[model samples]
Target: MFKGKNRFQSILLFILDLSILISSFYLASFISFGDFNPNYYYYSLLLGWGIIWVGVVLKYNLYEVPRILYVDKVLSKNFSAITVFIVLSAAAIYFFTSYKFSRIFFITVVSLFSFLLLIFRILFLYLVKSQRLKKDFRKRGVIIVGMNQNIQRLISRVYSRPQYAFFIEGIFTDTKLKGRLKNNHKGGLDDVKDYLLTNNPKEVVISLPHSYGDYIDELIHIADNNLVRVRVVPEFSEYLSQRFSIKYVENVPVMKFRKEPMQSLSNRILKRSFDIVFSLMAVVFIFSWLFPIIALIIKLTSKGPVFFSQERTGQDNVSFMCLKFRSMVVNTDSDNLQATKNDSRVTPFGSFMRKTSIDELPQIINVLFNQMSLVGPRPHMLKHTEEYRVLVNKFMVRHFAKPGVTGWAQILGFRGETKTVKDMEKRANADIWYIENWSFMLDLKIIFRTVFGMLFKRDKNAY
Candidate 1:
């Protein structure tokens, strides 16, 4: 049986990607020189590149368009695809043709292809999202097979992100919990086999706790026997860290837990190198000239240092002096107090800076020194950290990466004073997500969002 139209979409994407991959090189060559002329050996090189790129894309699951709308995943996969293509292309040429390749030509081709691929993925996402909102849009049917808090969480998560386009057919629970009040509660564990037979769902998600482990084997047999995919959400998932690494101890499989991507040396190098390059650009281009004017204005408007420095928790719960352009009058309570909305201590000029996030410009220095990242969890004051750690589960997980000047939480309106524990929890969750899913392209996306956010309007809670 066909599992929806996703396979058809994947086929279409394969063809489109192949066309784009070839067109990018042709376009690059035309731009590099005046015309496009290729030898027979070069034609062979293009063929080899196409084959390798296609395989790489498949390896990275690039054709799975719905779940991975994230630009970071697309970019990472494309980068890997291009890398494979380049390596395969080089080997084929070196082993076959004596014709030398131009360095400029290769660089231009790779750069153009990367740029084009990213554009294609972004446009594709917009198209997918719009299409998914249509009344008649085709969505995969998923059935939840157990009763627990996980079922509620799964429903809320699905509702929160419509881009996935998965419709819950019905939540079939084994127990006669409060959830059975709904009309879709087709049956209990006894009726699950009947539900699977009747509903014809593409995927069955099992969320039974370990205490109900006996039902697992039966459910899997039902799901697998009927050509539906089975997904198990282990009960320990809540207690374990965000991500897992699978290793083979000889032939046996072992699972190791981890929090973020920055734990790897290569990832660390990529983030640090980008941080240096970006900080240099900001320090040289924006801050060099702009800082003097801002400093003068601050000195004239407020009786305090030009820069505000406060100790904040960073990666590994280490403390660092967080830098910002001073935007408030001198005060003794600054160390202990949280700035409330329309705080009396905020100067007129300082209020503008805070609203526009201009006071944060000085943190680029922290980025340059490696104390902060261009994107990561935004560090909190020591006091706030201490208080929230007790209130929020896994609050310290945010410290897995170097604190960033801007972060996913801030972009998503989680910044400013925590009016309630729920607000702090939301902020902590966003930070945890960022830490768990760090990528250079995601960092760039966050930075882009932050810049546009600051330019367009005042942050409602910035005081």
Candidate 2:
């Protein structure tokens, strides 16, 4: 019943989107130009827009809905596609045209089309979910043929997202698993053939270690003979500590343990562009006036320079002079000792600056110099780096990306003093995770959280 369902849905969605775009353009023309009939130039513009829309739809893979679909995933994919389409349209208007298009009409059409597309997707998802709830939705029958942590995770994922429309028929495995996964296991691997002969499922998912190559191949053969689709889940959890992707180096397969978005030249350019623009804004708007005031206060309240510079680790395990507003008195122990709660090193105004995160504002200069990113793993002093490298596992991995003014660790309350090795470990883990899963959206999220926390939440660790 579910065969070719995705392709069918894709066709319907494409038709609906095209309809929305056409209706939007006409409606916009009527509203903006007081006529449904547009000029020849407008028709040309519409043709260009239609072509761009189709290209964008294909590029973002808007046609293929995953088996385990979620509302957020649906929305994110649509939003990305729409954003790219709008950007391309604007570029087209600027570079490719001498003819003047009605700005109001163009805006209205894009806005209306985007809104309608969003509404259509939401409605479609709601309908799919409703059908599933009523048991009117036909799910592809799937049989899992492994018993391990990865298979268990897959089972949990299937059960968790009922809207996915995948029904597990049975589980066939040789290994005996404990806990919640045990109930789902049917007969052993030997009985898989007999089971397939009797109760043929739509797909068989095989997740086994490399040691089971012969057995896994046999199982695949059996599934093929039974006219069932087969999927092999590689067991690399034991070897890989982070998210990995399989790539082909010529004819050889290579498993990359970490995927860094910043590795892409386009991503790096985007990040640097944003950093330059953001730092300029901060320097002009906030730091221009605030810097002098803070500097004067620190000079009067403390006995050292207004700006404190320390050698801290940056990307590629290199060291750079990290700048911050001096929040402490001149002392021999300043480099070696961490500031404790109500420590004597902190000045009267410095304590306030520390609490409000005003002291870190000078790092905006570092951002302008490309010594650090606006969001990443926070840089640590040389002493801390030396100590933590031996004490904490993967501590140095944080240096893979540029140090940040604020980071994932700081927002998650891993900031301030780390008195124990475990605390540093947690911070290191968060930094490593950020490096592995870095994205433009995630950087923005971390920045938002940092500002929000400074404004609303009190960080006891900030001292």
Candidate 3:
């Protein structure tokens, strides 16, 4: 029933659990007598533990969280449920098992498992949150047709959660109910159609009493004409928060969507603050060391200056000089040359630095100076930008944010030379995807991926 393909994620989780179980057994044996057998008892314990953990997750509805929910909330619930399960499991084992468990081993295992579970949840949530934060991840906005207390509460909740990423443009209600709404009353119901036409809200939420159900046909007709989404906040007493599936007569099935939780202003402010602080610290601590080393290597190996600066586009299509350690020969015609697999312009040391992404270290200063971000779309050269803007669809849209030191495209194996129009097209696609779906955790993931790639030496595309 999962919306996304997460088989790899499931396998990773299973491996983590298995590791915890096996380590617990080994540690317990080591502490007691340094001897343990892989017998029926061990097998039974592993099976029982796995089943119990999975059952606990199911019972707590951990897997049923809305797609747009923030990473923090999902992880908090998962952690609380898992901790309770571990405690109960330990109690049961102590009372029923013949072999006495070592307290230290039990504690260690519990702590380790808890940590792994939390890490996995954070990583998974970050990935999902990243996707949801994208512009395309937005759900159709719904206007509550009434201003009752319930509808007002829903509006308040939706407005409070940024991670919910649902924009509530305004509310449309009758004159009588309009006075009751604390805020978000755009205009009367009569003005809704015009507003919908002008502002283009994605959906309309009918929050009126049961008596107004008769207008469902009228609402549906309006929605159809405008090609908008429609939803009903039912007044039924047995309402449950559950997802539904939609199928056409002769088409692939699709999952019915749900309204997201509201994000608070404080949360947005806090996230932005975190981004600024984290990006600055990375510039000062990590990139500072690597920048000069790469610069020196480039200067000595090639006749060029230590740093290369080129005019590139930034947020809102603003131009800025993006700096990097020069990786090519001096005075070469940049307009005519794009790096190839064995470019003669690349010095021996420059090629190694490029492969490891050390040449891009100077961009950290850009991030610190607020000229770029630690993560976003990789900046393109002015000539390349001008060229691609003509050839690629929505290429200029990638200038929605400051260029990143490293980016989603770079981490997803799209870095280095763009030899063909198709190659540049793929990178542009990834760049736009990153802009539409930017998130704090996704930035961290890209940073982590970049570091891992560097260590493993996997940038074959770099000249």
Per-residue CA lDDT of candidate 3, range 1-463, in tens?
A: 1235545555565566567667766665565456665434655566667777777765776665463576645665676576667767787787778885556656765676677667767776677667656777655465666565556666668744556666666777774544435366788767776776776677787766677666666777888888788877665422533334455656875555322111334333433455578767876787678667766666777786888787777877788888878877775576555778887888888788788887787776676677887777888777888899999877786776668888899888888788788988899888877765555556667888888988996677877
Tens digit of per-residue lDDT, candidate 1, span 1-463: 1136577877777788778768866776677666676444456657767877767776777777645366567676666565556666667667877778765666777677777777887788788878887878777788778766666777767733567677777777766756423756766777788888776788888887788787888888878889999988777676664667678999898988765677878678777977898899988898899999999999988787999999999999999999999887889888888889879998999899999999998999998888998888888889989998999998888887899999999999999888999998998899988877887778888999999988997788888
Top-lDDT candidate index: 2
lDDT of 2: 0.84
| TM-score per model over all chains | 0.78, 0.83, 0.48
Off by over 4 Å in 3: 1-64, 67-275
RMSD of 3: 16.4
Per-residue lDDT, model 2, residue 430, is: 93
Best by TM-score, which number?
A: 2
Which ranges of candidate 2 are over 4 A from the true structure? 1-3, 7-43, 68-87, 100-140, 157-166, 177-180, 225-227
lDDT of 3 at 278: 79
Give the winner by lDDT: 2 or 3: 2
| Reference-based TM-score, model 1 | 0.78
What's the lDDT for all of these models?
0.80, 0.84, 0.69
Clashing pairs in 3: 134-436, 134-437, 135-436, 160-262, 160-263, 160-264, 161-262, 161-263, 161-264, 162-263
The full ranking of all candidates by lDDT, starting with the best, is 2, 1, 3
**Candidate 3 lowest-lDDT run of ten:** 258-267
Which regions of candidate 1 are displaced past 4 Å? 1-8, 38-48, 66-76, 79-104, 129-144, 152-182, 193-202, 209-212, 222-226, 234-259, 264-266, 299-305, 329-333, 340-347, 387-393, 417-426
